[model samples]
Target chain A: MEKKLKIVGFLCNWCSYAGADLAGVSRFQYPADIRVIRVPCSGRVNPLFILKCFQEGADGVLVSGCHPGDCHYQEGNYYTRRRMMMLKDLFCFFGIDKRRFHISWVSASEGKKWADVVTAVVEDVGAALRGSEKQ
Target chain B: MASTENRSEKNTRRESIEQFLYRLLKEGKVDAVLVPKRHPGGNIVSPVLISEPSQIKGTDPLAPVQTVNAASIVKELVKEPVDKKIAAVLRPCEVRATIELIKLKQLSDESLLIIGYDCPGVYNVKEYMHGIENREDKEAFTEEHIHDFLSGDGDLVRESCRFCTYFTADSADVDIAWIGVEPPGIIVAARSEKGRRMTGGMNTGDKDAPTVRKETIGKIEARREKRQKSGIDNLLDLIQPCIRCYNCREVCPLCYCKECLLEPEKMGYTSERYLSRAERKKQIRMPVDTLLYHLTRINHMGYSCVSCGICEQACPMDIPLGTILHVFSKKIQSLFDYVPGRSRDDELPLTTFREEELSEVEDV
Candidate 1:
């Protein structure tokens, strides 16, 4: 059997965590690769956490928060958007495969959308890992 | 006007600067002036805060040695409210770093006057200490350095300084310029209203900044840019020898965090956790998280980095951290169309965001 790829997911408590919970309750099946960690808001996710995940042997990382204006704390995800954007650029500059890192806006009501997002992210991460292994 | 023969005998430029600093003290223009002076028994030149006019005798404002960034000292000097005004003599990079600190709220500029100068770069600290070990006339050594630098031979300077484009103090309040002037002539150019007021009675030379100065700076800028492009490749390989001494962070002027997250205790690594990590990875680097430290530092302060190259100087492993950080930060700053220390009014890139900008960062 092949070893499982470890993907760390940071989900904002207000929107993304609720969305993931809704996906489970509604039986919307998605990849089981991600290990979810709840955060107060996307803004609370320091870029250090993402880098730390990579340092600790995580194969991929995902950060999900509420839509820009729909942030529970009001303007939390906006800061996350900017921070993550810079982090993404930094990752690329350091020769990290950008596809292994994903950012999304998931709403509490969007259970099906969350499931689809996870499936796509898992596929991308798997492909990226395989591509790097070949090289 | 003295003859060329007389100029050759006396170090006129150093003497004139010493005279200017003495006047600043005697005339009470500033309560004290912060300038570099040679330590009593060594070739080491460090920043000294001199209040007495007589103490300005051995101070060399144009010394080809940078012991510390000096912005960190400036930060410490004015961290709280002070009653006295101080004039800080600094190089172009030091002034830029000071401006960034002012924006970051780490340093207050209320009681500080930044006097910057045209810098013909300094040698690396180790190289400088070694080069001047047996020299008796330290002043002659500096004069020879300036002569070589003026003649466009930058081979003896630090690697970072050789490729540094900001060799003049354009961002400073008062700029003491000598790069393009005839020998022994220095021009004091006041850049701001505060500068103008502070230098009110001082007689700047009758001559305007020569056109040749601009041309010289342009040529240097072009050459350095080309050098910068070719020198910044293979960053990972360059940092391979880093011993995780944290010297780079200790000496960085911009790293003002009270408690750093990179500390060993903060990392929370137990012996069991280390074994587990090793087991999981099949093998692990002994002093782990070195790459993480560098990357995290880049992410945190890359936007505010002034490319002073002090970090490279402080590294025990001789990592070309200065070039790596400089090149990386240049790219990161360009993303937001921002330049650190360019202006006091501009908001830090990480602190502010546009509601309508960076739409591509989000997927789905």
Candidate 2:
């Protein structure tokens, strides 16, 4: 039997976490595979944290933060944006599928958008797993 | 390229630079001079810290051999404040690394004088040692290497050196400008107040930077810029030969962790954990996590990597770690428009960010 895909979501407390709560309250449907880990800010999310998740058998990882100019700490999301962009390239350079790592911006009011982003990420990760199986 | 007539003229100027160091010692401008000197046995050269003018006799700052990045040595020498100043003659990379170390609080730059010079490049240590062992006049050999480099011959140069664009020590307190200058002569320019004070009354005939020097440096940089575009497309395949020798970590000037997490004590697993890990990975390769180690290093130090190429030299596997790091760091640095070792005033990218910058990386 194929392993059930496990996704880890790193949601910022000020926005993304609240956005996730809104999604749940509104009964918006997204994959149940994602296990949420609330961090103080997206800037607190080290590249090692994501890599450790992969090492510990996470099939996919989603990092969602406050929108670009809306970071609660002013520029925390900007740092995350730069760091994650480089990390994504680093993963590809190491032969890891880019689909396995995703970054998005979701605010407390954007519950519907959050659900859609999760659905898109899970589908991409599923496709990646199938492609690796073929290989 | 220096003409034959220019070479002879520059030889005299080279001697004057050496004499200038001797005068610095006599004048007490510095407590000591740190520069590479030929070993008494001949054919071998290493950095020697000399306090006396006599000991400065064979000081050759232009030797195309780098035993280690001199900045680390500078770090060791001046980790604490000193009563007297020390003049360190360094290559551009060494000077740059020193600046970074200062920012990291690893080195106190107060009582140090950095005299940086134009570097043509260096050969791989093993290759340099082999090439010089049979030669009677090692100085002549080094001279020939520099001559060949200036004349468009780099067959003996290391791959990393060939790809380097920052050959001149623009960030150093005092700079020796050789580009676009006629042979046997170098123009020394002071970039700081301390530099101006030290070189003052030394009679080392200073001049304004030549107009042609910028264009010469620009041309070399443009050539290297083309090669910088080639990144390691298959990093995993390239690192497959890693035997877990920790040599790269040992020699990296920027890898300054007192307790490295990659050490055997930290990374080594118990018998049960090893067996379980192997089971999980489905017959994992022995000495597992080699790829993981490399990736972790890239993530940790990729931002500050100055492309000194010393780490690549330290690798037993000849893994081209330097070029790989340079490629990765170039990408990361560009994301924030951050250039490591550019200046002490420039904040580290990872430690600081602008509110308006890097918005393109934000997901919609």
Which candidate has the highest DockQ of all?
2
DockQ of 1: 0.55
What TM-score would chain A of each candidate receive against the reference chain A? Answer: 0.97, 0.96
* Best model number under TM-score: 1
Give the C-alpha lDDT of model 2: 0.81
Residue B243's lDDT within candidate 2 is 92
Interface RMSD of each: 2.2, 2.0
Whole-structure CA lDDT of model 1: 0.85
Residue B148 shift from truth in candidate 2, angstroms: 1.2
lDDT leader: 1
Q: Which residue pairs in model 1 clash with each other?
A: none
Give the Cα error of residue B257 in candidate 1, in Å: 0.9
True contacts kept of each: 0.55, 0.56
Candidates' C-alpha lDDT: 0.85, 0.81
Put down candidate 1 lDDT per residue, B231-320, tens digits, no spaces: 254666777898888899988989999999999787658999999989999998768878888988898788999888899889989888
Q: Which stretches of candidate 2 lie over 4 Å from their true place?
A: A1-4, A68-75, A131-135, B1-14, B203-208
